[model samples]
Target: MKRRKFIKKSLIGGAAITMPFVLPSGRLFASSGNRMADHVVFVAFAGGVRQQESVLQRYLDDSQAYPSAGNIMYNILDGAPPTDKIVYGTTNYVNGDTPIPKMLSQTLQQQGTFFKEVNASVVGHYAGVNTLLTGNYMFTQGLRNKPLTPTIFEYLRRLTGEKATKTWFIGNGIGNSIPLLDYSTHSDYGAQYGANFLAPIVTFGNSGDKHLKNAKVYHPEEELDPMYKMKYFLDNVWYSQGSALPNIGNTEEEKLEIKQFVRDMFQKKDNGSIAFPPISDSGDLQTIGYACEVLKRFKPTLTVIYLSNVDGCHGNFSSYLRSLHRADHGVGHLWDFIQNQVPEMSGNTTMIVAPEHGRNDDPNGIKDANAFYGYDHSDSNSQRIFNMMVGPGIDSNLSIGNENNKVGDIVNIAPTIAEILGFKNDIVNTGLLASNQSFFDLI
Candidate 1:
């Protein structure tokens, strides 16, 4: 079948055959409280960022014992760019010498509130993200298992009755148990209230080009009938065995929209029309590009984009610095696209950025090409990170906390998102959160 025709017909009959089923519970009632913003974009500016390099504006001084001290993350923080040992930018004959031009006219710190030093109780990747999404430390949460408590996606969907497509979790790739974060194992809120998840790089990269791009559009009466029977049989078997199949709950209409959006992305990628950042070299930058597409296409009430390129710090500090700089560039592009391209989310959206955790203060004996030592997480220094938010009604050019005084916890992010979307009462009243206070309360 022709690709366009396949998309149209697949929308009509593909739900039954699609794996990881979509079994939407009927929508509840709308939220009652007033919303601070029509939409919220939470960037898990993740991958174990170090406070010295990011928020402290110390480029090499703190990490390498160099006299140089300036910010490489110029788009998010208000500080001058590094003047020496410029190894964190795009290549200009010499490695990483040409910094990507800033995308936002003003830094996010200037446009919103900045939490200089936030506490991240969990230092590991999965646990830190679990804390950020569930608002509970869940120190016992297993690496490969779903979250023990309900995630913010669950609270928002269950309380506000938002559609599956209205909440999204866009991961850079499906590794590190990224695909499992859409929902949780909570009895009260599991797959039925999960967010739609997409690891765009995998979905649109080489594997997808071979498997999903030209998926056959099976005839409904002839081919779909047998597929449906098999699906039902498998689903019944799974259920009878006391196991529930994962369901993202995308309604038929939403599914159609999602498929169409995927098709459009492939075409856009081919034509070089994706809204990629000016320096779309790293995985994080590519992920941010697809994230921009998601926002433009879905206009979701809550969208979480996870970028982990900076995790390279474990082995290559130079690459980590480059990733960190590119991350800031990508974030600037994302915010700029939201404000200028996506009309629906332009003025009414709130953007929040926070790393899941921080890297250690001391080096781990691994040195990069620049003779700089690598850093690992697992100490008091790893608990230190920063959070920032920019949107309507949020104070501009405001900063809270300091080196000696930490202000917010990683767990506060979930409740902060709930508060912004007018579902804080619903989320907090359940008593499942580690702390009910949002960043506003901390302020």
Candidate 2:
């Protein structure tokens, strides 16, 4: 947290890699500060959902020919799913699939607060996520690099003395610099304070099963070839397309604890004891399952899970709707798991859900298998988004803002989370997100 010890440099592969705040004193900060909640789970409900299709229009009836026009997302919003469309993985189907039962008795909005129309900083996927996490709009940020500003994870760890094991970013998949968002390249806060990111599908599915499912330790002198092969595989596949390794920002003991957690997770997966809810086949649902596992095991202080199947909107409108609906279902299951299963984090955790950006108001001229028009986020409508939060310290059943009176910004999110964890001022004092106000303050 000290400003003077910022901006340190290091070398990697004979190239000057500047890693800031490497001093021992820089690793620990104001641990004495008060906290609003014991834990936070941030869902980057990503891949650009259009407001017209989501909070604003509520087009289930119109788009899917349902009997009712109310909310189809029964878990997150106070409404029912499209009873007739039945394409969004509902177990209740007439000729094909039956109606999938509701996951929760109470909706997330009924138990928490809702921001109907939050403003996003940018329309691009990576930039929108960057704004949400960093509390700053990186106008010049490329699609391939990490954010220039420090993320809330770095601020939370550096300002609160939270261990690396207490923070994690469970990604749906590693693409479009999604892995890079776990940390930042800021001078005062970098990998030393980054979150541990894991892509469950890539790490625990087919590739993981091949590479690490039953990985065993090797003796250095006896198995040099095997060791080199393992190292080569890790370097080539794990870091492919500019992806960084699992930059575990932890002490030696904490690192070992994380490794053990991963091993145990693999065992549970193999033994079919994960206790996941009955869910349809979707990447987002799979990611949420792993996220629940992480919560059950580690109960990390800050965990962010990203869902991106909705990006199918770019080429398939029908699939986009299905993905959005399934994403909501997955989210509902995750929240339910936290409340009913994770006893250690049940009542004390806060959950924040928001998309990276909104989709285009018009079609992109692409037709899908269903003959539905495809869309890409581009116009002003793409900038309109929303944020929902439920947990301790947040007002329940409260709705803020509307179409005519739009409030909140993507930048406000990071500061709001910082304030929830009692470090808004500390993060602002660092001059990283000085201009952004906490969403609580805005309301």
Candidate 3:
């Protein structure tokens, strides 16, 4: 109930915003993917995040200081605590004001291999989520009439050798449905659709889905018992929507193939298995829990996890201590698990954590009449996001690069992953494809 109101009030007028941050032009990487980043593990705030709450920020006006992110040691597993505040940069937090800053230059500098300038033109949750997940984006009004493009999961399958069969979109606030890039019905899946462009097997959930713990204990060879059925009816609902549409394409064979694919997906809905909850837009606790589960049990070679609690707490601008603490803790756990629990995950994995976008915060919402608008990220493309990188092949402490004010826009992520996976796709999506070579040093 509160969330619906939140969305309604936060909705911006007109079309959704689209900002593309492309990589700097030049040959920076001598090579790609260091020893530690042999594999890829991506963690993101499913929803948009203001820089104030995360690792980096772009500053224009006065910013506030909350808590400093403990240096790497402070976050070390069971390491000695720092006696003083682990201040990386200065903050000037005031009561009732948005806790975020208009600019976070210091945070940007300290943020190892992070992007300083990134933007999310849209303010709505769905638009931001779509933009972040898929390189393609739609502005506020355009989104209502149009559809988004394929996401990382889809790209991973089509371009890279990686299969969507093992992929997961855990705890999706919105039920999993592949976004459609083809604008018109003719270009889109059309009326007779098989499997309807794309679909993931099972969505991992949180407390509601307790199957994770049990799955961990059970051997992989063991057959999932009687209760583990994935109701084909649910998947068919999606297929039915596709099938019921009029034949979209000019050709008959294509139409038949489309319908056939959708039917096959329905029949095989129960085939794959995962145990995390569908993530909630409200916060990040469940996301942390899910990441821990993946690290402990199902360590898919290519994975993407969403963390948004920081965004939530910051948006409210009350006491975000809990949100920051949780984000820091969650990040620590993931890193620790990679090194300790899943030793193989260390050098073999490349971890990328980036926020959807930045915000305009200073901790005191009541300070002005503009409190409501103060809670969100600005439209300025020069400064509105942050990115973090770490892994076997990466340098311990580093910044993104020094070519452009921005490293790349939201569109570059898929290609970055594809590069790490050693896959090459000549055709690309919106904006220029950001090269993955920048990841070499951070590995």
Candidate 4:
């Protein structure tokens, strides 16, 4: 790695983006640098957010709503302590000295920072996630899985020559595609939708990395070489042995049926996998847990942990609060593992936690806030969503808008990360960076 090339921008064309290292394909690029947090763990809250309750804490600041009330997380804490809510839950809108209101309570503590005055273009499912993840509003494409634009992950890979194999997007219904995931430059490098645009060698998925599946199919004697051995074994013995599998019927049709059994062979005991038990059928939990486990092993330079259950909980407000807290707890756990559990990663890593978008302020029971009788996201102030970040050299005890109605735009995120990672690339600066204004200096 050419650590020198990644030095501060003063040396190269007046730009500084990280370390300049040569990629496997022999291209020199800059990376955020190999610090303890060389691995970026982005834990997403994954839902249409509610500012009044959790991160926004509007209900707290306004004494009129509930003079001494606490948000969902603080309310659940053992003593229902005050600091726990403000500190851990970014409880500024509520109270003070509650031990930074740690969401996991067992993990790290600190309010991190909040971007309160933020809004989105749409309240619909895909649009919310698209803008949040891509850092720019993607004009509605009518739910056809169109990404707003390329994402941070794509930029990271290009600047450093890292493959999608090193990145993981853990969610089912997210709207980011090649253009969004890869930033319209290099097509390969996303997990789920990789093969569609790039070759499998560079872009891959969990389906190809399930340990239990490898164990089941290639049992004790056949486990020596999982993929390759399975291929060899099937080639030599599949056609010859049928009666032994008689229940499956001995015919070309049966043979095809038997082979189809391996269709998703060892795809990580997923809901779609044969090895999955009924209890593990819930796709959301399985995905969250599986992706976290994968991160333990690969620890990719860039990773995204997608928790999409929050959107459903939005329809039911109380349940939605718990959902948000649980997701926050999940992020706290990931952060803990990096900062303390894994000492080397302590200050080197950086994390950003935010929701796909804001939910409609619906007092009435309805799905679409914009429906005839309902109001989802108002063109007015209440409809915008907010985001925050914490970890490694980040300013603790700081609040972007310690007060109410503070506006933090979406474009601020990508360039901030790009700036931290030291990417002088033009798009992030021109697109998301320029609009939102990077928060690099603040942290």
Q: Which candidate is the best by TM-score?
A: 1
How would you encode candidate 2's per-residue C-alpha lDDT over 258-341 as one tens digit per residue? 677777878988898765657747788889988998899888999989889999999987678777777888889888899899
Ranking by TM-score: 1, 2, 4, 3
Ten-residue stretch with the least lDDT total in model 4: 195-204
Candidate 2 lDDT score at position 39: 88
Instruction: Please give the distance, in angstroms, between residue 70's alpha carbon in candidate 3 and its true position after superposition.
Output: 9.0
TM-score quality measure for candidate 3: 0.54
Candidate 3: tens digits of C-alpha lDDT, residues 1-443: 99988786666422233322232211222223222344577766544455533433222122333233322212311122222332221234633222221121122123335553554455555455555555555553254433434455544443333322234444324332223321223232222221122212222334323442233232323432322234345556769666543432223343334344333333333353222222212235445544445444445556666555444433443333335434544555566556656765765776676656555544334322223222554445313655566555345556553324555666455556555555423214223233333333233
Which runs in model 3 stand beyond 4 Å of their true positions?
1-38, 52-112, 119-123, 140-147, 172-283, 313-315, 361-374, 381-383, 401-404, 426-443
lDDT of 1 by residue, 1-443 (tens): 69999898888677655543223344344565789999999999999999999999899999999989998998999989989989999998889998888888899999999999999989998888888889999878889999989989999988887889999999999989988888999988999899999999999899988888887655656876788799889888888777676777886568768888988888899999999998899889999999999999999999999999999999999999999999999999999999999999999999999999999989999998889899999999999999999999899999999999999999889999999999888788889999999999999
Task: Please state every model's RMSD to the true fold in angstroms.
Answer: 10.7, 8.9, 17.7, 12.5
Between the candidate structures 1 and 4, which one is better when assessed by TM-score? 1
Best by lDDT: 1
Evaluate model 3: give its lDDT.
0.42
